[model samples]
Target: MSDPFTFQMLVNYLIIGAGLMALGTLGFLSRRNMIVMFLSAEMMLQGTALTLVAFGRYHGNWTGQIFTIVILTVAACEASIALALILILFNRKSSLDVTLWNEIREPGQPAIVEDPAEAEATEPVPGVESYPVLTPAGIEPEHQTWTVHRD
Candidate 1:
């Protein structure tokens, strides 16, 4: 509770946070695997949280801690959603590569081809987008009546 956060310690925390952010950015950019990319995003979140906690500690306020909690909560939700989606994606393609999604574009859309020089570490594939088409259960609402005009 009375721990003093010296300038040196603050700087170290900031530096470490910055490093984590940079690493996460790099990994998110260079990797094509969905899981890996998500992991990188988590890393970035952790880094930002770390920086927030450091600042909050230095200022002797709960703002940083509160923000960190929110960040962690968001990260957890994101991870859970991402994992579920990844499982679905893996089931569809039988792999965790990201490049396979390039083909799921509009008609005549050029396939997304990653330059080997830019990101040679990831894999690739071709795919189509499919979604359930739902029919209206009742009478459609009129769009004109839904509009609100303010004078």
Candidate 2:
């Protein structure tokens, strides 16, 4: 039996997948948060899935679909690992800002620092707020005298 979808439809699917991958790459390059990076990675995977599905449909075989299922499984595993890594990183610094981990570099390499002027000029994306900082409590209380012996 002849396939229901036209060649043009397959091309469209491929184009859409390419677009998704591009968008994900741009997002990955621009974002600093680990969560955002993971989301971008998922977007790229989604794009790949779309392309694979299109190929499977065009070839009249289950190969593409099977590959997509594998991709989904891998993506799930990747997401879980990423979540755990993010949680550990956040616990260490108590902040999701990736710059906190800049010290993780080659032994002899100097740390990379963002220029202050650029940092000041580039405002965070709208609606993206830094998490609130907990207020510092007062200093340790003094218990200078234990008068039990005298009493």
Overall local distance difference test of candidate 1: 0.86
Tens digits of per-residue lDDT, candidate 1, 1-151, equal 5667988888999999999999999999989889889989999998999999999988889999999999989988998999999988877777677887778778998888756577445443344334445787988887763323322
lDDT of 2 by residue, 25-58 (tens): 9989888877898899999999999999999998
Counted clashes in each candidate structure: 0, 0
Give me the displacement of residue 148 in model 2, in angstroms. Answer: 38
Give the TM-score (vs. native) of candidate 2.
0.73
* Local lDDT at 133 for model 2: 56
80 in model 1: Cα distance from truth in Å? Answer: 1.0
Model 2 weakest lDDT span, ten residues long: 142-151
**For each candidate, what TM-score against the reference?**
0.68, 0.73
lDDT of 1 at 129: 33
Best by TM-score: 2
Residue 120 deviation, candidate 1, in Å? 8.9
